[model samples]
Target: MPNATTVTEVGQFLKNPPEGFTVEAFGSEYRVHCSEENLVFIDNFRSGDCDIVFQNSLGRKLKMHNLWEYTRMRKSLLSKRIYVLVSLCDQNIPESSKKEPSEPKVLQKYVLSIDGGNPRIKWQMERGLDWTISSVAGESYRVEIDLSEILESLAAAGVIAENLMKCNPIWKDSSFSLKYYSDALFDFPHWFGFSKRSFKLRLIKNT
Candidate 1:
């Protein structure tokens, strides 16, 4: 059993989770437990698999799973006054390849934001300055884009690229924070083609 205040705190923490905090799935629900604070309990219970017994510092315990109930719970929390903040971490492409390839490979990188509750992209980079097109006719041209390759690289790095492709505007208007690339971007060799970039998004509150 999680109270409204506790649930709101949990959501806030998830928005900008502190270092060392971890999330794990327990049975059919998700649990965010912090060993440092000795807190552990289910946060979402919509699967109706609630035969669990978990406790936390707040002194609330639960053992049931109902999707509708969970939805109501989340709505109850969202109905309260809250602030949302979106943050983007710095991304840097390494100059040296981990392995050599027979042919030259063009590698592009991207930083994107996905919905924590769903598979959607709140924001992402559309194209790089290097992107170009070759005109073939008066009204026709061959568009050359590296977005696909860049997305593939991000996916390989464990990002949810498929969901990011949806390009949802749900997060529009939300305050955003970013960590700009530091001097590390120029430390690599010039031929390595190192590039630095940023991504943006906005989040809105129900209230």
Candidate 2:
């Protein structure tokens, strides 16, 4: 069971997670942390069928067939909204065949390199983090977050293409507004952008 204080601490830790924390879900002590890979896994796990696990410093394993259940449980214990940030590395293009005719290729490196050029970064925020803490749970809680807000925060963080910036170096202040992107440019393609950037936000929850 997690408490309000524990929830806050976990969120903070994720914002600036300690170094050397691998994405493995097992073989670790009981502490809360997150990584880009882990977040992606969780997101996909919730939307589809999959399993996830985490290990604590003590090298104990915690397995969950469905992360949505645990995510809800965490929210139930919190009094404030919890923000989730996910960063990914951009992929590099593969070498093409010189002699034989081949189909056009796309890179799959996914690792972003700043040395090449400044890559646009994207971030997402979960607008409202709602949860419930029941005394009967003996300290455990459940959590629910609006996915819409998460997508908004990510777009707000600048998920637009790098080439677009070349044409117009500056973007309108409202360019990031959720309504604008959700309605105006909902079908815009996200390309030639960096992914390894960091994102942070507070969890705002009501009483």
Candidate 3:
């Protein structure tokens, strides 16, 4: 498992991505220019499980199913800087896994990373949003969101929606019964201001 230090290191890397490095959000890949001698490519694949694949300009390829294995194997070949970059790129694995289980455990979390500068933004927005779902055994699902960062993002983006700034908004204590939607397909859209940009959610039930 990755610890806080690892997560923090990754966050710092993103705050100031190194030169000649670029991240592809759609494919979840990182391209790094190691040096004139070597170039590194990191790609993430999601099947039933998550996997990380690394390749170099020299045509060498390495794949690891988990971070522990990847860290250990690449220690010799990768420098401290390169290692941190790779580790940060792999941090998304745990985030993606948070939604894997059919039933919510004690608490399940989902993180949304927003681009404040996305040309589509019409107002202020949140850059990082954390959505948490809590359930007790088989009881109703309780959903809550951490909105501080979102408010800041919105303000930064010049979004002027007053409703978004109200205290303890509806999202704070929203509840839903798992049994009600157990058989039907449902979609929920979280709209940001008047912009057509929204997060569309599709519910999937396990049989």
- Best by TM-score, which number? 2
lDDT of all predictions: 0.28, 0.25, 0.26
**Per-residue C-alpha lDDT of model 1 across residues 1-207, encoded as one tens digit per residue:** 221111122334544544344555566555544443332223222223432222232212222133343334334222322222211222232357535433222121111222222211211212211132111111111121112332233344444333443432121112222111222333342124322222332222220
- What's the TM for model 1? 0.19
Task: After the best TM-score superposition of candidate 2, give how far the Cα of residue 188 lies from its true spot, in angstroms.
Answer: 43
Candidate 2: Cα lDDT at 200: 28
> lDDT tens digits, residues 164-194, model 2?
3233222111111111011223222212221
Worst 10 residues of 3 by lDDT: 172-181
Q: Worst ten-residue run, lDDT, model 1?
A: 133-142
- Model 3 misplaced regions, further than 4 Å: 1-15, 19-41, 45-75, 78-207
Q: What is the lDDT of residue 201 in candidate 2?
A: 31
Q: What lDDT is obtained when candidate 3 is compared to the true structure?
A: 0.26
Candidate 2 TM-score, C-alpha based: 0.22
Candidate 1 stretches greater than 4 Å from native = 1-64, 81-87, 97-207
How good is model 3 by TM-score?
0.19
